[model samples]
Structure formats: C-alpha cells, structure tokens
Target: MNKQQTPITFWGIGAQKAGTSWLYYNLSKTPGFSIPPVKEFHYFDRDTKYPSPNILSITKTRDRVFSITYLIKAVRAILSSVFRGNFHNIGFFLKWYFSNYNDNWYLSIFNRYSGSKGEITPSYSMLSKDDISKMYNLSPDAKLIFMLRNPVDRAWSHFRHIKKRIKGFKLEDVQEKEIIEFIQSEGQELRSNYLRTIENFTSVFPKEQILVGFYDAIIDSPEQLLEEVVQFITIDEQSNKEFNQKSDEEDLPTKEIVNKSIELDCPPEILNLLKEKYHDMILELANQYGGYFNKWYLETYGKNSVNENNRLQNTIHLN
Candidate 1:
C-alpha cells in the first residue's frame, strides 16, 4: 500500500465536552496511528480569504447568505465530477485545493506526531452538508470515527468551558438561565434534526466505513476499545508501548461539578426547565450507554463507583 493512501481520519463532530481530547490522546498514542497536532482543525466550518498558515485565525462564519454560492458550486462540481466527466478531474481538484492551502503544514504536524494512518480534526463532524459532500468528493474511501455523549451534559460542559475564555466574563455575564432555556427550547430540534451532520455522514459513507463509538465506552475500556480501534485501522498492536502508558491527567468536569456550575449560574426555575427539556434525551442516552459508563467507572476506580454514582445522581437526580 502506498504510504499516502491511508484512509483513516477521526471525525470528532463534537457534542463538545464529550471527552474528545482524551480519545485523541489515546488514539495518538496507539502504535502506527497518526493523529494531527491541532485536534480540532475547524476546516469544514467556513470559508475565508486568508492564506494557508492563517487558516486557524479565520473565524467560523455561520452566515447562510455567504455560504449559499459555495454550497451550490460544491454540489454541482461534485455531481458533475462523480458522474459526468473524467474521474481524474476529481483528483486534480483535490490536489489543487490542498496545494493552495497550508495542508503541508497540517500534514507535517501529522507526520511529525503520527505513525501509519492519519487522523484529522474532530471539527469535521460540524461540517456543513456542502463541506461534507466536498470531503466525499475528495476522499470517498476515508474512514470516519464519531463519539457521542449526552447532549445536555455536553452543552453544559461547553458553556462552562467557554465562560472561562471570555474576557471580563463572570459566568453571570451570560445568563445561565437564558442559556439553559435556549438549550432546552432547542433540545428536540437539535437532537432529532442532525440531518446536516451525523445523518449526512452516515448517508455518504457505508456502515463498514464508519465507526460510532460512545464516549462512555471509550472511558470504560481504553485499552480494549483502543485495541479494537487499532485493529480496525489495520495498525500493528505489538510495535508500541505508548498505548499502555498512563494517560495525561487533565481533569474534566464530573456530572456533579457540571450541575454545580449550572446551579451557580442560574435559578432553580431555569434549571428545572433545562432538566425537563433534556430529560428524555438524557434518559435515552443513559439507557443506551449508561451501562458502559458504569462498567468503565467500576473498572477504573473499583469502590469509587459509589462516589461516581452519587455525583451523577446529584447532578441528574436519576433514580
């Protein structure tokens, strides 16, 4: 196999605060696996007029008005190249696009840090339909890996993390009540209508080409889960000990801490509303992945499972 023909890419389309960073770390450590240095290369989020290296500085502009033309052009170009004319044209276009940008710089980071197969940004999950279609046009054979978590918890975690970055921002600066209200109001719509993201991803890629792992599963069995991932990507397990080393300790908010943070930010009424809106989704996720979380916690800390359960109960008050 040609070195450049590797098809593995991690598409972390984040329910932010879903232990994506932890997964990235573990995946990178796996022998013969190559993960990019910049974990979230928000490439497919928007288009801007900046040069290659400054791609990071280009803010993600979510305006539909500006994107319509690009979207149309991308769709038309993809359809035309896929069915109408020479297939070589598609390869030419991909090379041209990558050559114009600092993909070399991006790829260099991967080469320096990676092994055999390469993983790109998690931000690929947030890609617009047009952007994803373009990705399909560029590399239809690329393998996709997605990690999902409880959306409500994910949103809450995202809010708390973002609060720290805004200057002069008290958590109060952005009304926690209002934030929860917005999330609750939008919960069903957001959860059910992922047509533009996850649904689209599944549509274009075959089931065999994609791996949908839950964050809960990854947290529970890092070694086994990672070994499965390594096998899936066809990387050798015996060549590396990095996967067995202790993972870097970067503390993330527990369910208790997240809820406390939420309580600190808003009133009881808003909190209740947020809970009500998120309740069904949370229950669904718990029913699906809670077992994994329980097993993972039990294995990782043994008797501390009680403490973890207490913390989770205190947060969601799930019986």
Candidate 2:
C-alpha cells in the first residue's frame, strides 16, 4: 500500500434534511473521491458497540484498555493488517478493536476505506466547541463545508420527518406542547445562533479552508455550485461531471403534511403565538441572507412577482 499522505474529509456539520443526504450521495459517486460506505458515522455522539464483523475479540486485556503505548502499537498493527487484507493477522484484528481510541483513529479508517478522499458525519454541525476543536486538532488541513437552508422550512421539514420515525412510540413524560416548544426552540436556535458555528470554526481555520453554500443556490443551480465544490476539493474533470449529473430531486413533505404536523405538535394558542413571534424574525433572517426565504418561496410555490394591481385584486376578493 502506498504511504498515506494528507486526506481530505468533508464535515457536514449540518442543518439536517437540508440536502445533506443528496450531497453525500452525489459526492460519493465521484470516481476518485471515497465517500464513506456509511454516510453518517456519528462517531463523536457516543461510542457504539463494535460489530462482530469488525471486532476480533471481547477479551479485556490490560493492553486493550489501559496502556497508552500498548494501545498505539496495537492500533498500528491492526490498521496494517486490515489495509493489507490480512484478516487472520492478530495485530490487524487488535487494531480494529481499538479504532475508537480517538478522532485520528476515525481518520485512519477513512484512509483505509478510500484511496483519494473521505468524509465524516454531517451531524458534526451539532458538535460542541471542544469537539470541533478536537476535530481541527486531529486533522488540521481537513476542509469543512456547511450547507444552510431557510430555517423555518428546514425545521418544519425536520420535525415532520422525525415525528414519523417515533409515530407509535409513546412519550408519556413529554407532552405535545413540550415537543413543539423543543422543535420551535431548536429551529430558532439554528437560524439565529448557528452562524456562530462558522465564526468558531473560522477562528481555528483560515477563511479559504471553510466554504459555506446556501441551500437556495444549490437548488437553483446545482451544477454551478457543485463545480465550485469540486474545485474546492480538487476533484478531476470526469469526477466533476459525474458529481454534477447525480443531482436527484429531494423528497419533501407536502404542505398538508406540514400543516398537519404543526397541528398535531402544537396547541392552537401556542401555535398562533409562535407564528406571530416568528414572522418578523423569519423575514429579517430572509433579508439578511440575501432574500433566501423569498427565493425559496418563489421556487417552491412558483409565484411570479406580484404587481400592485394583482395585490389590490386579491384584497378585494378577500373582502
């Protein structure tokens, strides 16, 4: 195996459901780029039990658990065996066992999985300050890309999506109001506060290393935006064409589903209050982000610019 040089990792650090899956799918298809087999590794959230396929043994040896020097040597051996395709090598098996030691171990896993480039969990957007710093420290040169969307729409879509997953799961401890409140709060936080994620990351890495793309731009002209992404990652021409062609229509909930979700998740009074509270804030955010909300609305609703006469006619019809 060729000695590994610096590897590029894409961190989704997300506005979930904001075209992240689509981005991952298309980028993974790029011939030279090695999108991880599992898109959302989510290693930072919590350590999961190792799969039998990957885990060599459960025997608790002091070497596996205690000694830092022993652990590093064991990891190096395991990595070598795995990469060499020598499954029977005990050292390789042992390295696989200790792969969860640090974020660097995860980066090594990416190197093994793909020859050219690798990306990690998009959920890194929700990481705390310390985690982000640790990620930077582990791979200082790793490029970061953040995908952002209209907060109201993104949040509503996310809520409906998550609610479907836990449809029959009872939550006796948490009331519907609380759930709605949680959703509303999270939505607002993403809109208002998540910009700080950029600030925090930029503090550690230079401006050029970090790229931010709006969801509206991606939807409007994916080819162009994807080309920019390809340039940033230094992907080849053939891979660029493949990545551009892989755009698929993202599945979104219908208006009826969104309304139904709001009804089911919020009390009428609270819903009305939230609508009133968020209307101005949403518009302000829209304006701040270069009318991102308006662009999204027009694209989604297919409304041409309304003239004064049309507005007057609509008012008369309402009366």
Candidate 3:
C-alpha cells in the first residue's frame, strides 16, 4: 500500500459504450503509459460499503456473473475457508468490493510500473459534483477524457446492454412498450443526461483539463483521435503503435454478449420522444464543440432549422 506521489495523468470518464474499452485497451499497450490489469477501477464511482449483490439497475451492476472461472474461484475460497475454519470467502468478497477506499490500495494497482497512469471507468459519468470534487482532491491535475455519442444512440446501446444482462431474457422477445417505458424511466435516462455530467466535471476541473471526444469521430478516424489523445496526455508519440483493438466493434457492457448482431429494437416513437427532449441540448453541444453531433443530426434526422426553432418556440409558449 504505497501512496502515489504523482497525480493521475489521464482518465477516461465516460459516456459508456462510446469507445472507452478500445481506448483503454490501446492505452494499456502503448509505451510510457501504465494501465492497471483491470480497466475499470470503480474507485471514484463507489464507496467503502459492501456492494449489494441484488443490484436492480443493470448499468450499476458489474458485468461479470457466475462464470466458470468465477465458480472455480468461489469453490476454492469456500473449500479453503472450511479447512482453515475461517470466513476467508466473505473477506475476499469484501476486499474486492471495497478495494478503492484504501488510497494506498488504489495507488498500488499502478505502482508496479514507472510511467503515466490512469483508469477508464464509464460509470464515473454518473458521479455527483461532490464525488467529482473528491476525485479532484485525489488527483487534482488528472486529465479527463469524455467520449460522447448521439444521446439517443447512446441510450439505446445502454438499454440493449442492460437487456442482454438479464438472465433468461432474449432481447428479441422484449416488448416495444416495455422497453420504451424503461428507456423513459429516470433510472435509465440519467445515464444519458450528458449535459449535467459534463458540467459536474468541468465545474471542478478546468475546461482545458477536460477533453471531450465524439464516438462517430473515433469510428471515422481512429488514427487521428489516437494521435490527438497521445499528444494531449503527453505520452511519447515516438512509440506510436497502430490501434490494434477493433475500434469498429461495439463495446458491450456485459461480456455475455459479444457482438452488435441484435437489431436495435427501439421504436421510432421512442426515438422521436428522445429527440424532442434532447434536440436543443444536442444542438447546443454540437455548436459548442463543433464535433460530430451536428453532422450526425443532419445525417440521421435531416436539416430542419425552422422546425427546430418552432419546436423551441412552442416550448417557450407552453412554459
């Protein structure tokens, strides 16, 4: 348990499913960067309490379940506990769940190497301003990277991710009405309230310390994005290696699902509702960042300035 003398150099604070896994995988392989064996530290996102095994929110739960490897480990721990006449298995679970509270424990994860270190935990986006402030206290100079996608698309992906995780649930069998209700529900919608999350991080961290990227751009030109990230983090560009990770592949939240073969089951009505809800925010973000959001809106929904303005005007009138 050694305390880190240096602040964390980089972070991928996220809009999940937006190329974070690809970023983490590539950064881990890159030179002059020290990435821990586990990609998501869950340090800033969690507290020092026993994590509930009966977590209802799919997004809040860890992706892994009782896998063959996990089963073997559990059996070994149980057998060891019985022989030792002690509850070692319970201790193991506690340590794994609450490992982040120990500052030295978190630091030790990256202490094996001498280089710039960081973590890529998508759930950190849901953190409160107070939590982010605490994170700043831990690493005041940490550079934050946020990758965003079209909110509708991001939410849809998130829904699909949750759907895939439910045991005995086939996504195709899910009803459109039920899915739409779930999407519109507060629990799910909060994850895509990007405006609030971004503000929370930027309000504490200087705008220059935060780097916002787009998922479409990452797909369209990963090499450019890779180089930009490298330069931003001050990683040695001389050791630049090609991004071998399949950036094109969907970064599913759960390991149970491997591919994006499942056709998105979101109803057009639901999409329209989301667009109506988020269009103004989306437009503002696109305008502010000059990134892919505006272009994506144009391509997906077509150009309609008059209609959009009218929609805003109607909202004003209604208010």
Candidate 4:
C-alpha cells in the first residue's frame, strides 16, 4: 500500500443509549466529513485481546447480532476502492481485524479521508482512566464530544437494547427482578456513570476541546444542537474545507434514529430502584449541565420516598 496522509481525528465518546448513534448517523450524512463506514470501532475501550474478525467478535461493533451480509458489503467497499485505483487504508484494519491492536492501527482507520474525520464510538465512553490517557496522548488536539442523558432513562434504554439485541429476549417475558439486576450490572453501571467518563476525559483533554451535549437536545432542538457540535469539531482550520464523499454516503441514512430501542415494561418497583440507584448521578449532571438534567431531577424526584411516583414517571413509565 502507498503511504497516505494521516487523517485528523475527533470523537463522540458517549453515554450509550444516549444520542450518540443519532449523532453518528447525522454526521455521516453531513458533507465535508468522512467517517468509518462501521459506526463503532470498539477500539480504545476494548480489551487489548483484539479478537478475530469472526462474526461473533465483530458483532461487538454494533452491539447487535452479526450479519454475514454486512461482511459482504465491507468486502465490496474494499474492492470498489481498488477498482477506483485507491486502496484506502485496508491494511491496518485487515491486520487489526485478524491480529493485535495498535495505536497506529487505530489511526489508519480514519486515514481514508485527509480532511477531518472521526469515529463516533459510544463504547469509548467506558474506557478506563489509563486508557483515556493513552487516547489523549494519541491526538492531543482531537475534539471530543460527549452527550449526556438522564442516567435513569439511559439505563432502562440500554438494558432493553442489550436484552433485545444480544439475548434475543422479548420485553414482555422479562421480569421486574431481572430488570433490577440488569440496572446494577457492571456494563450498565459503567456506561451510565457519566461522572467518571467526564472526569477522566477532562483530566486529559482541555475543557474547550471537549464538547458536552445533552440527549434531550436531540429530541427538543436537534438541528441547533447538531450545528453546535459540527462547528466545534470543524473549528480547526484543516476541517474547514469541504470534501466530497457523497458517493459513499448514498447508501447511508440521512435523518433517522439509529438503534431505536423498543419500549419495555419498567415495573414500579424497578423504576423506584433505578431512580434511587442513579439519584446521585442525576443530581451531579443537573449541577453540571443544568437544563434538561435539572428538569430530570426535579420531575423525577419526590419528597416522600423512593416508592412515590414523581411527575414524569407517573405520566409515563420511565422504564
């Protein structure tokens, strides 16, 4: 493979079950950008094992069942690049897929586009402080984005997502006790712990370089929120120029929610526990972000006790 220019990288390190997927979808469609065709690289936060490219291992990319059909599409993209006389940077990923993970291997994923490019991987949010420090050392100037959601709601959405996608279970058949256990599950707690994610990243990256957004913005004021993030990412002079990836984006989504979770039953007891479990997180986010999080704490917390249904939970089953 011929030498290529290193791409400028950015991130959407996230609070999963938040609006990260939505951010990824819209960013890919927006012009002047080139993102990996695969949404989640699962690189920085993954165990260094760097599992093989078999369907089971690759399934972690989207946190959904692996489909052989997608593999076919990937091969087709590679072959098309060759026919166009541009090999892209298949070497790093091809090797990374079958071999060990390296920092260079991760950088090469974004090498296809010399213009500003990045991977909007939500799993990166769960990375350890040491791992995040490694991430900071990599692209010191890389603009990082984090979208916060109400921890309680994020937990329920995340639980439903995994239960439906990975476990192949129906929400109707799930028990309240199971929901409670899942809320406290290690994976769920780690991702929902926005406080940890922020502290780790801010300790490394300058505060101005990291943009924190709210998932509520996507629902309430999507365009404005998206515009803010876009400007922050492209503020660097190199990212100012426009690029043409229209052909690549033809098959991708334009305006839609990705990985929309199915509504699941949140028993009153489970809801009570979840609100209790994430109470501190809610108060912290409210103190930090203020707008929606402030509303989340006020609307969800009642003076009586954990059992008392707050205004929002009473109106809608939060779980």
Instruction: Choose the strongest candidate by TM-score.
Output: 4
lDDT of 4 at 17: 83
Residue 73 C-alpha lDDT in model 3? 58
**Per-residue lDDT for 1-319 in model 3, tens only?**
1234654788888877777777787677655677765577677665533121222122321443434665565566656666777553445444443343456555555545556678888877877888799878777777888877788787778777776666666655767788778778764565677888877888898878777766765556665566567667764444333222333343322222223423456677777877787787777755554336556566556753322322110001000
**Per-residue alpha-carbon lDDT of candidate 1 for residues 1-319, written as tens digits (9 for 90 to 100):** 2436434344555444555676577665555566544465655553642111224443433432266764575456556777967465455333323333443433433334345545445455555566677666545666666655544445555556656565566655665555755565433234322224456776666657665555554445545555555455554455334433432343222212121223234446654555565454444344433543443334323422322332221011111
Each candidate structure's TM-score, on Cα atoms with residue i matched to residue i, is 0.56, 0.59, 0.70, 0.75
State the lDDT of candidate 4 residue by residue for 1-319, as single tens digits: 1123335558888878888888888887666677776777776756743221223243234443155776675576666667776554465335434443467666656654655588877877777778788877777778888887888788888877777775556756766667777877777777888778878887887877888777877776666576667777785443433322342435334246778887777668888898888888777655654556667787789422322333221011011
Superior by TM-score: candidate 3 or candidate 4:
4
State the local distance difference test value for candidate 2.
0.53
Off by over 4 Å in 2: 1-5, 45-98, 114-116, 166-176, 184-192, 235-319
lDDT of each: 0.48, 0.53, 0.62, 0.67
lDDT of 2 by residue, 125-163 (tens): 655666677767666666677776655556655555556
Off by over 4 Å in 3: 1-4, 47-100, 166-172, 235-261, 304-319
Return whichever of 2 and 3 wins on TM-score.
Answer: 3
Ranking by lDDT: 4, 3, 2, 1
Candidate 1: stretches off by over 4 Å:
1-10, 48-99, 102-114, 166-174, 177-196, 235-267, 279-319
Model 3 residue 18 lDDT? 74
lDDT of 4: 0.67
Residue 282, candidate 1: Cα error in Å is 5.3
Q: Candidate 3: lDDT over CA atoms?
A: 0.62
Weakest ten-residue segment in model 1 by summed lDDT: 310-319
